[model samples]
Target: MWSVVLLWLSCVPAGLQAAAVYRRDVPHQKVEVYSVTLDCTVTSRFAHTVMTSKALNKANSSQEIFFDVDLPKTAFITNFSMEIDGQLYVGNVKEKEKAKKQYDKAVSSGQTAGLVKASGRKMEKFSVSVNIAALSSVVFTLTYEELLQRKLGHYEILTRVKPQQLVQEFKIVVNIFEPQGLAFVEAEASFLTNDLLLLVDKTVTDKKAHISFTPTLEQQRTCPGCEGSIIDGDFIIKYDVKREKSLGEIQISNGYFVHFFAPPDLPRVPVNVVFVIDRSGSMSGIKMQQTKEALKAIFDDLHEEDHFALIIFDNKIIKWRKYLSKATQQNITAAQSFVKRIKDNGSTDVNSALQEAVKMLKNGHRKNTIPERSTDMIILLTDGNPNSGESSIPVIQKNIQAAIAGNMSLFCLGFGNDVDYSFLDVMARENLGLARRIFEGSDAGLQVQQLQSPLLLPGNLA
Candidate 1:
């Protein structure tokens, strides 16, 4: 009986040792890491790691203290659940999954795995997501493909993450596959809604190339009871650095266009013009000659559809035209002939000419009936003071007020020293136009250029 008992004890010790080894090898609940990748592009390529976790507690005891992971400062996270000690924590799990997928795909495709000497290119960074608690056994495997391309001859890959219907983030990673070299970098973004916020980060391992930046955004914000406000945001940017030739050239083209095109689209409203010229005695010499030349240029530049009329103020108000005409060859030639025939006459009646121009624009003759066209315009040019009908500046101003009530634009040009520039400036401001002074010795061509430059083209006319 004693011998049998000793044999049993020895076997018992062996059995206990086997059980301990089994427990050490087997986990109560497995933690597996799976990869998900996002395929798209982001504006800026900043280096950072993103962590994602999901846990399933099958124990009936409802135990807490499940998982913990460190997060990077510049990383974005969403759709993750956290349970500390005993309770479930609700956060953004969707965003977490999206971020995970982006990173995983980037890693598996060899796009973000560091440099590969065989291809003469290297994977600089990756976008990846970690999936835990999905499989019963702790197993890790890559699960996505990434599409990579060369932009302006530089290696770059884009990854997109859609966490919610209204929210999204893009990750653009550039692989400096070449040896250390200098590169230029720029970035921009356009969102469907105004409230979306964007974050951009860039880093260069080596310094060798010059960088230029041009950024633009077409932003629209909604207001209560008011129509949406459209704003164009543009920034001029430049940077220079040096590095290796192996990285090639990183050309990001989407961020390139806004540097050139945003400003011209904003606040460009059509202009209204009224030609008020002096056909008086003082303007008879080269002054009148230059005036006519300037007038012809103005006529030539007028949009075919713009609103304009000619009122030559001399001893009397000569209303040669009552409606704006296209700058067609025929109309311009006829207008030019009329301007040439304008001889130095008795006295200057500036007030009468202004009144008549305003009257013609306000009356809206048969030829001036385009729908939705902007305000009418009256361009006034003169070389002498009011010496005829309604010479009072106040009376001329009253006519101008009436024109404004009708929504007109008034521009004034004064030639020689005889005209009143102060009054011209007042008229221009009242009607949202410009007032300019042309000296006797000034180049008439230059004056013409200035006058014609501001007139809207036919395509620009509303």
Candidate 2:
């Protein structure tokens, strides 16, 4: 029971919301947010969420407004649009470079420029500013979609709502479709807020699910000129479907189909794991301590069939083992000790360190005498940008690409807000994996364990 409690306490939802206020050239200008609306639709295999925020100018002069919002790393944005001075501007998804070029072109052509781009794992930081005439309003809308990833026999969907400022009107609606029938469904908010009113459709069916809620703020009786609302956390929903005994399930809707495959009782396969850590000076305090703790926990949980290596980098790189070693009792203990002794001091060399990790994995894959098919993966933990060696992001990206050549998957864990999450996100996507941001205040070990689940793909269930 205690272990269960600890696990739940450690593994809370991993969404962090940061707010950036628009700076007005003329100080003391007032900007009032009028409303915020959220719509989410979920199917057995996928979910789509959209947010629209409307704000109006309260100052006598024209006002400029900007909004920065974050989203989960797994989400793929589908659309972004804005209404300025009664004109609507919709942004189309394009290649990152192409999108940038389009945005630049719009600005140069004296048109309303709008852009939506991914900044980090499960997070999209978007900022758009337009000059609004006095007493005028602007509405900005963003839509994104993500796979309803399955875990522990259920499907999960998560959405974040944080409009830094309290609005006059706020609402959210969720629609879920599950032709397989829902065994159960649950929705919850992270904090207590009277503003959130959940609405459920009376026409309930085994295949249909729906929920709607509104978050608002009320004048605080205790404090003058203050408001009360839970505007900081995530809105999460999870449900399990009644499955017919089969190796997989498929759902079809409106000419689109989704397949869910879960192989049964697959034996564990051996895996080669490499830990690439960044020990820059910026990671000297609590960040380093938590990293060590996470590493220690990972070490203690390793299976004997697994082979592992550790590579730490700052201005220089150090390898715990020249080659991968079996995760025996002795080796695990040694690895734990090595993790305990890691100290932070130098500048970061992200490019070279990652290259070294991939090289080690490649060499191990070719030379290992083990007969079982072992998956090769590199877990990179960093807290800073590449500054010491091969500092250019593009150079580092191309170099790592050439080194791995699609031989191994790279998963990155960005330590704190100081790290370049965009860099990590891009690198992971290129290598057939993903990146995650470890909020400095959360349990780093839990985040590490979350990523560990992907290691247990049905084909490599260990």
Q: In lDDT terms, which candidate is top?
A: 2
Best candidate, TM-score-wise?
A: 2
lDDT of 1: 0.44
Model 2 collision count: 7
Candidate 1 per-residue lDDT, tens place, 1-462, comes to 000000001111111111111012233332321221222222223222232332333444322212222221112232333222333333321222243353344334322111101111121111222222222211111112222222243333222222111101222233322222335544333332334333333454444222222112222223444323222222212322232323233444546321111123344444456688888887777678778867866766665545555777776776777565555677767877887888877787877777777666556643444335555667777754776777788777777667567476677777764457788888777776667766444455555554454444322211
List the lowest-lDDT window of 10 residues for candidate 1: 1-10
lDDT of 2 by residue, 185-227 (tens): 7777675345342332223478888877654455211133565
Q: Once model 1 is optimally superposed onto the true structure by TM-score, how far is the C-alpha of residue 372 displaced, in angstroms? A: 4.2
Scored against the true structure, residue 141 in model 1 reaches a CA lDDT of 18
TM-scores for every predicted model = 0.40, 0.58
- For model 1, the stretches where C-alpha displacement exceeds 4 angstroms are 1-272, 365-372, 457-462
